[model samples]
Target: MKHIRMILINGPKRVGKTTNANLVADMIGRSLPDGCRAHRINMADRLKTLTNSIYNVRTPDGQIAPPDYLEAIKDQPLEIFGGASFRQALIYVSEVVIKPRHGKTVFGKWFLDTVNQVCKPGDVVITADTGFASEIVPIINQVGGDNALLVRIHGMDASFDGDSRSYVHWKHVLTFKDDTNAPFRIGDASVRPDVLARGGFREIDVTNELGFPERSAQAVLDYAARANWLVRPTEVDLELAKGPTL
Candidate 1:
């Protein structure tokens, strides 16, 4: 164990997750030595080229399956395609067969590999995080789970702060329609707080008390202190907090 703290930022789109992530990273970095600082990696950019590469794929029976068709057939009975014929197809469909096909590619092992290679213990690694915990947490444990923290930034929902909106009483998810015929995804309120509560992780509600930028930064530092990370905000951290230039 290298004694590193990795802050995995989780939240829905348009919910100020990246902004808060940068602030937390800067605050953590400021607590470290002058030359060292927290490292924030936006995973989408790192995996772009690999995700874009085109691969010509043929199933076991020499039948070529396009990306869509490969995914469409994953859970169907093998009897339809013939057991032996589909078996080979299954092996070749990397995109379709990986991690039960979430909204996009799960990026599971490969993403974790990149994170492991780039970050070590004692360093602050904050990622625009995705991929389910099942695929990522085990690898993190290989280093040290004690040093890791998963921060789930729930979208700002002021209603939840009011007594009228208890967790059980309220359930509203925002959905988005794709203009270009892309997949229709829930946008406004898809992230569930209960699921994030698992794994004993800390929760920061951007909905109330810390919805604004400055408050969000303070909330993070406060949480770190409460958790015993012992962050003493320095001049550099103050400067970093002024704006997200870095």
Candidate 2:
């Protein structure tokens, strides 16, 4: 059977996990042979789709808006839902309703199903929004440990100051809590150090210091070098090739 590489990006809120995923996808797409490209998928996509359906709302083009758009208008009260903001509604449906009914691995199962259907041989599938271990363990198991890469992004400037997202408090939730000592802590949440300890899976740590573009580019370069893929010369290389500026 043809194999695909799966990159799972894990990090706190607003730390550019999605940015890195997209950058890695683009980089892989350029390096891979013709007819094979990278694909970006979010673990929360199923949640967003369910949220949109429950609210009976669709984008202007008759499609559901992604979670980021919902987050942008998260505080806007929904009249039909008794003034609950989009964020509140999503939390209710996901945590309170779905998990209680369908189990915690429901989203994970859906994600795996999607990956099985859509991902082909030689494709690099990257996901930026991997929060809980429950959501990704099955993926690692399915894709086999050797084919998966877990990238943990650390944003030096990131803070939990005013953020009230459910994920921020996940470490405290009984079902999601990890008993093992975490390697790092982001706000109140542990950064899934347990998941990182799994054998046979390659792990990468990216410190987001030079902002998204530079850091993401650096990440892709690192990944390419590690994966033995053809490394494309970056802008820095081009500048260096011309010698130092006076």
lDDT of each: 0.46, 0.61
Checking candidate 2 for backbone clashes, the offending pairs are none
Best by TM-score: 2
Taking all chains together, each candidate's TM-score versus the true structure is 0.53, 0.70
TM-score of 1: 0.53
State the weakest 10-residue window (summed lDDT) of model 1. Answer: 168-177
Write one digit per residue (lDDT tens) for candidate 2, span 1-246.
127777777776667666667666666666666777778888888887788787776777887665565666666787856888876777689777676655555566678778888878877788887766656545654555557776777765664344333231222222353232334311222223444354455666778764334555467556755666443524334222222211
lDDT of 1 by residue, 74-142 (tens): 334454445523323433343343323432223433455566677665566676544234333333433
Best by lDDT: 2
